[model samples]
Target: MDAPACAATAAQAASLQALLNTYLREMAPGSAVLADDRSTVEIPLSHIPARLRVRITYFSATGPHRFGPAQILFDGSSTWHSAPPVQVLTLIAQECFTRLNSRDAGQLPEFLRGLFNSNAGIEQNLIRHAGTPEPDGFLAAEQALTFGHWLHPTPKSRDGLTTWQQAAYAPEYAGEFRLTFFAADQSLVTLGSAHQAPADMLRQIPGLDGAFRLRPDEVMIPAHPLQAQMLRLDPQVQALLATGRLRDLGEAGCAFNATSSLRTLYAPGCRWMLKFSVPVRLTNSLRVTKHNELETGVLMARLLKHLDADGPRFRILNDPAYLTLTLPGRSESGFEVIFRENPFAGTDGTGIYNLAALTADPLPGRTALLTRLIQQLAADHGETPADTARLWFEAYLTCMLDPVLDLYDRHGIALEAHQQNSLLDLSTGLPSRGYYRDNQGYFIAQDALPRLNALEPSLTQQPALVYPRAHINERMAYYLVVNQIFAVIRRLGCDGLAPEPDLLLQLRRRLTTAASRLSGAGADFARYLLTAPALSAKANLLTRARNVDELETEAQEGLFLQMPNPIAAAQPQPVQERTDVLT
Candidate 1:
């Protein structure tokens, strides 16, 4: 194979190995082969009894290693070599099914295909990004995620997109396309907004030229290109079109580039980011907007507006408006689109990056944005890389964790602050602020409803959105603690800036201090996080293997496994005097 092909194969194999290793550790703990020093361990495959060597990392039990370029082997011996990633995954799946006496082994082939497609998507994205001149800092960071979620088995998979469509709409490829617009009669449109009417919001968006002017009785709504095609075939949409209630305006306005979230698009000079409901399944769930989610967005915006009275440390990128068709019996028409506040509108010098993309490994041999930022900080301050890493992490925790916990403790609002939904704004290589987006993932605790209702009376109408305190803690523990913070610690370690244990120790110190300053439930939660024996992490591999739609599963109901808490495991050290790292 050629060099590029060989690299792609290696990436696929590495992803598969990561998934399998997670499964073995969680599902069959006794299968691991540990070294005397515990720095390196091996997992003996049940199907072949041959060990696959892995290097140890923080939080998780294992990290990636190079057995060979594209093939996995038993130790350094060439005698026992496994096939490609797909075949290896199939073998592991077969063994897992046989062990559990489950019949869902059939799902393995589909997941394997997804893995291949994901690899292809990454390859295409790399080629496109290499050929294209770099974009602005924020957009470049947004589109830089080639290989997606480090833990997901098929992070780059676009299940229903064709190769051409993938090139035109996938964010990694820097895809840009005109959004398809439709004119719906005023009577058929359901509008919701926290600030302005949905129709007014649509009218204010630039680049919708006079050629696509709306009539007095019609309201404009935008749809993704693929979603537009799907809408044309939908019975409800066709019925409305047949009755002259909905008019197809075709594709119009300026080209919008897809962001990291495939359905969300960004247009230069536009005041709002458009998030459309696409029917295609990406990763674990179909990208469709439900009515409740729209309602939740408006509610969240109102709550944030109330919270903003007391100067929030982080900004909530609110989805202020949504446009959707209101069919007689159908709650959602699959053409729902949200108008989210655009923070990048006027800031040309500042850098805003999706936290997930920032932490991801960049192209081979290239330093990731996080690593580059740390190196630059070290150079600027004349500090060691390790010290810079510790300082940078301190600032990050202060900016990110404090606000997240404050919201949960004070208002009962638990954000889905996973890496993808969270963003960090950096000023001169230091974290200046943090932002959290996504309306579908916010959770409100039942205990805080009265306070929230006092702030916004309409919030009490949807009691189902409220969850128990324990449930919120679990979700927050996974997303904020396990997936977000620990992932950053691991990345810093992997990049050689600092050892993972040192970072964990620093994090524990910070959390301990924060906990002392906090009160009530927040203080207890912070203390728990600092010394929890184990943490609940989403089991992405097992979740995908079960062919479950994560969105459908409740936050607490999805597959979870206990990962040893690095903070808890670290030995206590003398507390150092805190410095003004934020400066």
Candidate 2:
């Protein structure tokens, strides 16, 4: 590749850097972050007609850790000598390794290669993994390294050519990658001619590329074929009195509750949703596991992380009670106490099995943007076929509630955010609205609060009373943000609403505009809590939680909310065949 192409790649990546950061922060927070001086992000790369500007970092594009510690340097020119790695390589590798033995045509070599070639590092792995040991070092494991240049055949096909050569010409593969050498430890230490990274540079990054850190605890709703193979041996569970498999983290009074939100709930470290909450029924105690609680923490962290970052889908949740609790049952594994506030106070209602209704329709959220949500989400992302551009507007809400539980637990901080008292939105599945119905308010124990006085501290009016830290944050974002003033554009990303940019930009404008009208929610409410200054810094980690089982999120059209009136939706009319063939 030439300098211009490299520069273009850099430019494209740079231009969209802010946009991507904004989106990622909202979608996944643990991984999305800014550079030291806030100049770059982990995914700092671009593609142009000729060259690509690159940042060589030890990042897994598709792995659970999106932004691990990066060297944070750039490869000024696109050194074509070695393979050109795309920014999303690591993630692709993680996903590929995850889907290595899958039966889906969508995950075959050709498709996998496309995602991998996008990341230079992954392509190197592809080369190394495919090689065989030679007398000197190694030989091409499979002689003749014929990769993406020609489509690989899958087991499902017999009329092979139909699936290969006919593939659309979009330069389907990513940056080029050839064979590379791995050290005794299977690290990408040595490379052949295509080694663009110099020895010194290579030594700097070393071989932590595939380093094992934290295992992901995701629940797979439709259990991907490869996910089954990735489940590691279950870890021992932890509780106040005893220990066993994570599934057994409770004593006599543990709740065996569950959720159906997560698409995948069986990821190694994140499998069950049994130990986090107060025990409702004790009979199902044996069914809980550690994987369950871990997933809950992950989910909560993701939720709060998004709110802490800047995004168009900001939720006005102030409760930080969303964290991995060490209670009995599975709730202990995952975080507990989801804050029901504006935004996430709703559901997508995209039920368990809607294959028939989902036939020719694109993404349901994008399709119903106009009627489903505010006018903003419908306007963003473009008007392509629905299936082509789908975003999880429901995710925006689930993410909101899940985070409050996250922040509190991580800090060993607890807030009063009971689900029964919380309000959730069930309005249009994708397009919905959630608010602190009656401002039930955030609560803290009589003596353990005040740590966040800088945020909002005042002497407790009543004896032993403490301040509600989470509530303070909520009022700032909700009343001061989405409501109170109309200047800020509602950053609601409901599909078919205006594009995300317009909505967020408008939110900023409106937030500043109506900054003064937010006193109705209450002012002194936050100043009354106490802090648990004496609590130990080290928290007892939990293990027996699991994710909620996948259930029918999809429901009747009006399941989420009641319709103002039963207005009949017009069905699509068939179009007549065109007779212009002769003309």
Candidate 3:
């Protein structure tokens, strides 16, 4: 009836099925979406939207292993004349679980990639990625789970109806795709193309190496022309191919490449800061940055178009990166697009008083330093409220836990919470608004799935995204709570006090108790901040990248506007301002 299920050699199919069962049960345990009847199931993915969407059906285990059909519609079609089954769908069930749940939702629990990526800091990233991972391939069954089936739990507004269908979560991939089967080392034209690239040198092709292939599952051609297959990469990803510029932002081993079309973007209400990659020149994933950055911004803007602080601000402007996107559009090969930008325009840790500043140099110690100033300024005016300082004091502070709650309430565990990827505006400082970014952090559903009963209806049910909680915690511990937050505080010591390392323990305690009923955001926890000794001497908050005495001299009254540190500031030279022009 169905194309003979498990088309691979019996050994290969069994081995893959077993590996998948092990991976999913362990990493994504209690995933209610798992059809409990068979080792695998088949539902054609071709009848759905062209975006990242899924339609699930199931037949779980009564066999050697349980399996189900998720039917991910990647550019839907009944039959896409593709490469051989081995080249495309052999052990299709296994890949469906591993790739969709692990790679897309970020990472899975104890997944070696996540383990190493999170625990290994920056020094041993490759070693981290190289290690064999857990066999959670059964997750593909969960991929078919839709919003009505699971939806994010927190941010309980009518907006909860939003799911990872189309606009955000598309079931497309790069390696071993369902599109045309390209030989890893197949001779690729490897043409060097970009906007403003020299026409004479446009087609000097190189070789495509390794068993590596660019299988863009979502790509389709009504009529195959120059190439037999087309790949529908993320729009932002297409821009990378089109522009070819992404920067190697420093990491332990440069985990992900990021380039920038604009040296800076000063979007006022944007949730995530947009940062583009360096102009790309390589044809491998190793060198190219991921596409979610653009999707991060665009998706936020479009989805939150109605909400207040929940969504992101977007600018589909023709930035320097636009040059690349434009050319790719002309090639008529661009699949989908994604985008991002820098958000630290005015914030240099100045313009307000925060806990990080509590221990840092010449500023006065742990008093409500900024608050006191506002009260003084207000009292001076015989005013009633001193709301001014409170607004400025909430630097880099995030939405109490909206994003994480949004995920956890729905999917269970959403990881990657930190100050750097977080966007907030103290420009008006009541700590009223901010944006969250970085999708490749963490997710966990294992424990929570059973606690809440996945099959039963609960207020927290969410459209399915691989719920990988343990993996999420690891990211929060490493990237956000520890690395980014603590690192920034250490850099900006309070008043005359030297930076202390234990500051994280203190901060962690605060974060842990943040949601407790007794506390309005765990206030009593970090109050040592209030008693911090005042500066041996001081200046306004805007005096960034400078000593207290120097900064004080530069402060324009206490109400500081973000400005570059004097002397070291490289005011953009008109000639240098255009950083995107190719030489």
Candidate 4:
């Protein structure tokens, strides 16, 4: 095959492999029959009417497995043949449709379309970026996630973006664009800040290209360029523009690059990173900020300041301010912008990376980024790759896992430190510190309400910020243990850095030791991880199939599923469950 055709074929295979991995782990966990030699796995599509089965090349205990073209068997047919991704996805969706309730079953067609769109996006990324030189620094890692979420079925599905727009806006495309500005009358705008005044931070955002200045009587709101286009079609915004209450200043800013999260923009030397509400569906939900979320972020920032000083070497990049329009009869004006403190500004962001970006799969025929980092560290220290990786994993636990557990134990606060929301400091060739950046993910346990009320009387009053203790425990299991830590194990195994079984043992020992030292829910959580036969995990495949908007879903929504715990499986002896279990 020629080079371009070969590249397209490879990209499709990669997309199919990712889809299959998610299907096996989340949808049909126990149904896959593995060969004794461990060379292939056969999965039966039991929910579908057709008597079909899929045979793949390889399988992994952790989810990142090698998969070749899948051989499929049709009903009452003795012959087997290779099937394309579209066919496989259709079969999977049909199976899901059969299994879901009538209401959810209606979402099948949209789900299938999203899968196709995601695959097309992946193909475009691979073919277009084939000859492009890799960029450097913090932005480099942010732009490095060519293949998006490992477990998400429609990881790169851009529902509202056109082909040209994605090229200009997507981080994978290494795109940079000017921010759209709007000057709204201060009376019609709502501004909140936990630290400096909101206007002061706006003034420091360099590069206003046109006649755009922050006025005392108005609020300057910066938005994603795509959002500006969508807002022009809104009747409320048009009425405000006609009445001279809001002036569209157009695009007036320095070129800001898209971060891993496409809605958040970053510019070098900028004091604050601007996160705006874009009118697009990135994965599961529309990328619009809620009014309650803004209040939650500012409250969390203030609460963080009052916490004890002797915490671990972990910091949460604070979202201390926000700017938005408060229109009558509207919950969101599509102009919500958050001012997040940018510590990785200028020359200081060299070795810091979003953990998701660090762990993302490389392009076809390229070495994974994490593998290269581990190899370089091993070579520098004159140590074996296995030894270096083991040390690296231990350091990660200290920096990332320890801090999260400590915070939950002491404050009953759980940050959604999932792979994408997490940051790792690799400046010293080892993880020395960890950071989390998310405004809408902080969860305060109801048990800690009294203590938090003493600190800030209205902290719990913030909308959707507090949850029952059991619910928080469930979220901790899914976000921290399953999504974040298990991903590390899978990467190590997939990249051939270290054995997953060895890493699982290492993780169990660390958690066991932690369970002995930690207090309250933290200790119980550790114990739960060690002893629970099944742990909660976000069922991304199923969530997509059911068309659930995760951000808009209530606490009782069915967004999670139980998966067999690898940690519990690694234990040599069966441990007794505690009466006061946190999960």
Clashes of each: 0, 125, 90, 0
lDDT of 3 by residue, 326-424 (tens): 223344222222223333323432232222222111111122232343444446555433232222222233343333444444435444443324433
Best by TM-score: 4
Local accuracy of candidate 4 as per-residue lDDT tens digits, 1-583: 7667766786677667767777777766677777787777777776643443455554566566777666677678778777775677677767667656546534777877888898788888888767765434577888877778878878878888999999999988888788888989999989888889887787787866335765678777888889899998999999999998899988876789999889999998688899989888888788888888788778888888899523457988889999999989889888899999898888888888777777777776676777777788888888888778888888899989888888888888887888888888887787878988998788888888889879877685774777887777778888888888888888888777887888898899888888988987778788888888888877887877777787688752337788778898995545342232110
Taking all chains together, each candidate's TM-score versus the true structure is 0.92, 0.26, 0.29, 0.93
Indicate the residue-level lDDT of 567 in model 1.
Answer: 80
Error in Å for residue 221 of model 3: 19
lDDT of model number 4: 0.79
Give the poorly placed runs of model 1, Cα more than 4 Å off: 1-3, 47-87, 130-136, 309-312, 554-557, 575-583
The candidate, 1 or 4, that scores higher on TM-score is 4
Compose the digit string of candidate 1's lDDT tens values, residues 1-583.
7657756665665566556555655566676666687565555665564545545442333232223322347545776454566565666665655555665556656767776777777666665554444333677777888777767767777777887877778887776788899998998888788888876666656767575867899888889998998999998789888998899999777778888888998876788899988867777777888787888888888888987722345877899788888877677878789889887864652578778877776665467768887887888888887788888887788778888888777777888788888888776577778888888777788878888889888787776578887777777888887778877887788788877777888887777887888775566667878777887887776777677776677542358887777788887777565575534
List, residue by residue over 1-583, the lDDT tens digit for candidate 2: 5544543443323222222322232222344444564333543222222222223231211111112222323365433332222334333233332323445454334433433222222123233323322211001111111121001111011111122221210111111111111111112111111112222222222232332221243111111111111111213222321321122111121111122111111111111211122211111122222332233233333433433532332233332222232433433332222222122111222211111111111121123222222223334433322221223322332333333333333332332232112222323334133222111223333323443332223313222223344434333233222221111111122223334343333322322232332222221121111111111110000000111111211210001111111001112234242222110
- What residue pairs are clashing in model 4? none
Q: How big is the positional error of residue 13 in model 1, measured in Å on the Cα after superposition?
A: 3.9
User: How much does candidate 3 score in TM-score?
Assistant: 0.29
Pick out the ten consecutive residues of candidate 2 with the lowest summed lDDT: 535-544
- Ranked candidates (TM-score, high to low): 4, 1, 3, 2
